[model samples]
Target: MSTTTAPPQPALPIRGFAEFLGTALLVIAGVGTAVAAPDTGTLGIAMAFGLALLVLAYTLGPVSGCHVNPAVTLGLLVARRIEPAAAGVYVVAQLLGGLAGAGVVLAFRSGDPSFDLSADGLGANGWGAASTGGYGLSSAIVVELVLTALLVLVVLSATARQSNAAVAGLPIGFTLVVAHLVAIPVDGTSVNPARSFGPAVLTGGTALEQLWVFIVVPLVGGVLGALVYRVLRGSDSDAASQDTPDPTTRAGS
Candidate 1:
């Protein structure tokens, strides 16, 4: 008699590639809209990020869980939903994708004589002079910390049960929309480190100078959010029981 072995999920590289493509598309749509349509104001920009993420959640939810954000990867890592190696791969891919996406935006914007990387700057996240609302550093930190926590909590909670998978993207995406709506004025709404990395690097100056805040703060928020999820959902016993990630509920951030 032969016993059957369950099949493993897709290879890490495949998942990493999906993350890369997803992140790139997200930046292209979200950042592109923000830069090109500044006249449309905050509502339009928030919707762009939210809608792009909503679509990516469904399209790439199965392949590699569609993290697309370093903060999200960190959140899953804290929740024990993903391994360290896998999370590292996801972060690296997301960073590269963000850079590529910024490049695409730059290419398009360059076509117009009025466009200037230094003057106009990429849609990079920052506070003080870099902030659209002229918010200070303290304000920036507080908003990022609180909003990132909420975003990560939503990601973990919405994807916790298998039954939630079919409809998880809606809440997840809406959470992002709400996050942006509230925080955009504070620091350009960088709950995701990968989303900030690309434009900041390309734009340089203050965005680059304050890059560490965006990267470090959101990751801390991810961990905090995971801890909150554990407490609210009866602790780690449930998540720890399954040594491997559950395929039914594909986790995305």
Candidate 2:
């Protein structure tokens, strides 16, 4: 019997769309929750972000590795797991997706008579006056850098082995939850640049002005996280040598 092999699917556009949709859903759940229900408090908002990503990971992981966050995409890129061109596409898609999701939230929110864009910030991230806990610039920087690194590290490590693929989303999603739990009161937990960009662009003012912090710091954090992953994972040759086993050992010893 002869079997015919199927042609490989085009990766860029399809994967990019998956990333777009996944990121959009993430913003819709996380930012939307923050905007719609400020009363639910920090844990509710954190869970919103985490649960959305958990579902998106399983839904879009096969298509695009479900890197809905640009920081996560950058971590994969630094690890050399993704080509530069593909990574660019993924980032662009994610930014546009975030904007789209925020637009959706704004559209419905505007209908509310009491919703004032200026008075009620649309879940944009920042420090100082914009911060929920009145955190300073330095505090914002450290929180973003550290928590983003932690988030990127979890994403990198959990997805390292194919055997772990079945549940990689668990740790990744949980890490985001923990990051938010810690940073929500500090600077609204912008481990995700795109997530911050969406609401900031629409809401304007401080969130928009301070957008650079959310963007630049998280990217640096991603690179740092990737490099740490490299150290802990060791070289590919080292992994291979370890897998070869020691022939000098007696069989069934």
Count of steric clashes across candidates, in order: 0, 0
Q: What is the C-alpha lDDT of each candidate?
A: 0.83, 0.79
Model 1 C-alpha lDDT per residue in residues 1-253, reported as the tens digit of each score: 1232324678889998999999999999989999988887888999999989999999988877778988888888877787889889999999999989888888998888999899999899999998889999999889888888888888888887555678878988888889889998889998888889999999999889999999999989888887888888875425442522443235454
TM-score of 2: 0.90
Flag clash pairs in model 2.
none
lDDT of 2 by residue, 1-253 (tens): 1132223434689988987888888998998999998888999999999988888888777777788878878877777666689889989999999899899989888899999999997889989999989999999999998888888878766665545667878888888889999999999998988898899999898789999999999989888887887888878523322232110000000
Which window of 10 residues has the lowest lDDT sum in candidate 2? 244-253
Per-candidate TM-scores read: 0.93, 0.90
- What is the TM-score of candidate 1? 0.93
Q: For model 1, what is the alpha-carbon lDDT of residue 90?
A: 90
